[model samples]
Target: MDLQAIRTFCRAVEAGNLTAAAKALHITKSVASRRCQSLEDGLGVKLLARNTKGVTPTDEGALFYERGIRILDDVEDAAQAVKHTSDNLVGTLRFTAPRSFADLKLGPPLMAFAQQHPGLKLEMNLTDERVDIIGGGFDLGLRIAPELSDTSLIARKICDIRHHVVASPAYLEAHGTPKTPEDLKDHNCVFYSNVEAAKQWRFGTGNNARAVRVTGQVTSNSGLMQLAAAVEGVAIATLPDFFLEDAVRDGKVIKLFEDVPRAPSYLYALYPERRLLPLKVRLFIDFMADWFAVPENHCEV
Candidate 1:
């Protein structure tokens, strides 16, 4: 089988037309069409259906495309594996991560990686929204969650993250401190709307666990905004330790209910599952693990 023809067919399926695929592959449309025709003839199956809407993969073609993607990925991974023995690393790494984490924790180490490999280019999309890593053409993603989502991607644990209920000293002074979890109900609580239970904050551990229904002066999807509100003495906020570390260290924010316990979440590095992983992606993952292993690199509660 011709890998080039298979690649061209897959590209055409992804691009939704031969013309688009040709432009992307830097080949003429006639060449792309010829490759697809040759692929279908060799396989004895009509891979694509052409019409006024351009071209679309047939049912069998769609299935073939999926396998083709993995085949191509495996081929590239094999090439990268051989290249791994060299001292120099070169490639573009496109990844996505949460905005707050990127700003506070990820930026430094990733920048150092970029500096170390001058031939490498990094493109990072920092947002809280869950991105379609494969569809979006991202090489890797960093996610912080209590439980991993069911997906085809491979995930490796980076570190454990704990949430802290905090408020400015002035806010606590004026509104009074919450001595217990229940006391939060009486205070103005800033909430991260993106959280699963934005209004319901849980405390303690198994068997003794309890949930508190909280109402606040403000609610937003951004954790940074919630942290800002808490810092300005506007409302109490439950934020990850990484975001509250500097604030607590400077006395800008005070952690509440030191005795109360909150469920701990984890930071994970996610990437597509492949038989032979790329050296660049593997190197980054290793670097992140090492970076987080150093206590000073992460926030301590």
Candidate 2:
């Protein structure tokens, strides 16, 4: 099979149309179509189903694309190994991360990594909205949770993160404090509406774990928004400790249920499963793991 043909076909599949694939590869639509046709002819199988909507891989094409992607990654890794040092790595890495974490904690480390690999092109989308990694063609996804509900993606735990239940003094004074998970239902609570069970607030871990259904005047996808509402005495909120550290220290919010023990959360680097991971992706994962392992960096959050 022609390497260029395989490359073009893979790009077409990812881009969902010949015009998009062609534009991405800096080639004309005719050229991209021809390359894909040549690839199909050489393989003796119809790789793509084309229509007005877009092109999608056939069953056989899906199998071939999966293996083809792995093969291409391996070949690229070999070329990079011969031509460049680890620091001299080059390529575009597109990723999506939660805006709450990215705004507060992700900038320094990401910038440092980019500086260390100046040849690399970084494309990041920071939003609390959940994104489809495969559909979006993202190289990776960064997430924070006690455990990932999505089993489709492979996840590597970069570091541990803590979640705290917090409320302003006035709110607690007015509504009284929640001593147990069950007390949460009686009070107005800020909800992070992005996750699977937005209103279900979890506490503890292992056999003692439980979730409480909560309601409030405020509902937001952003953790920062939830934190702000809690600080302004709107309602109680369960947010990552990174967002609460400053507010708690300043007496704007009081950390509650310290002795109750909530489920542990971790910073995870998530990516799609593949036969062989790309070198750039692997390097970034390792870099993140190492960077967060430091006491200063981890504690800063």
Candidate 3:
């Protein structure tokens, strides 16, 4: 019935005991027990069966528990919304992002956002492996490339990443420049082995994208590794611009077929499906969209 009492009840369920719940909620066990008791009494149902091992939610308790979770979420959302619209949007934004994107650039924008919104806090996780944001307890996520599997989460396309087929200047000179996608077949191509068809490189061919089957003397599942190989003139690599900025800038790799058509991977910001996402999540998504809106965001892989 009461928000605080329901919060206490859910806390007890998550913690498995009144004492632990109080510890988690920074309240006394007596207060925790009182809240849980009041919540159960108001609903006219036994919510928990306390035993020597721990507190377990009963069948009726389980039903109440689900509703209780939503109630707690609403309370948190309300508090965050209030603070968000206030002078400072103060709260922690738990974020996950692709590994390459994080190591290179995510920190600067997030740092700037935090500086502007002094009350905002960020907990960032960077990894190549796709994460389950809801299951992993993340507030939001950043992703690039073809949209992965669809879920209940809300995804916003932030930018388009136009990829490049580049090889080191030396490699181009040694192997000869590839004037077309067919030209790559003659050159030793380094590949991202993790891709479903590493041996089959796709390129724009009229109305339909055509696939080119090739042999690579060197290959690795890691995009970074492939970039390194391409930089050293081992072989030509096709990778997103984000991972090859330095190499491309220094003329280490030469972008080929600039006039030809190419595929573009999209960058996206994702959040849960809840109607009331926390202010932290909402603002973080806005900041990311703004940060990636620059002209140089062309990348593909």
Best model per lDDT: 2
Candidate 1: segments with Cα more than 4 A from true spot:
1-42, 46-70, 81-86
Q: What TM-score would you give candidate 2 relative to the actual structure?
A: 0.86
Lowest lDDT sum, 10 consecutive residues, model 1, at 79-88
lDDT per residue (tens digit) for residues 1-301 in model 2: 6888887888788777888777666788899899999999988999999999889999999999998888787887788788667778887988999888898888999999999999999999888888767556688999887788768789999999888888999998998988887888899998887877888878888888888888888888888889889998989988887897789889999888888766788999999776678778999999999998988888333
lDDT of each: 0.84, 0.85, 0.76
Error of 3 at 37 (Å): 16
Candidate 3: tens digits of C-alpha lDDT, residues 26-109:
688899899999988888889999999879999999888888778777888777656567358776677788877777766677
Model 1 residue 262 CA deviation in Å: 1.8
TM-score, per-candidate, Cα-based: 0.81, 0.86, 0.72
> What's the residue-level lDDT of 288 in candidate 3?
73
Candidate 2 has an lDDT of 0.85
lDDT of 3 at 279: 66
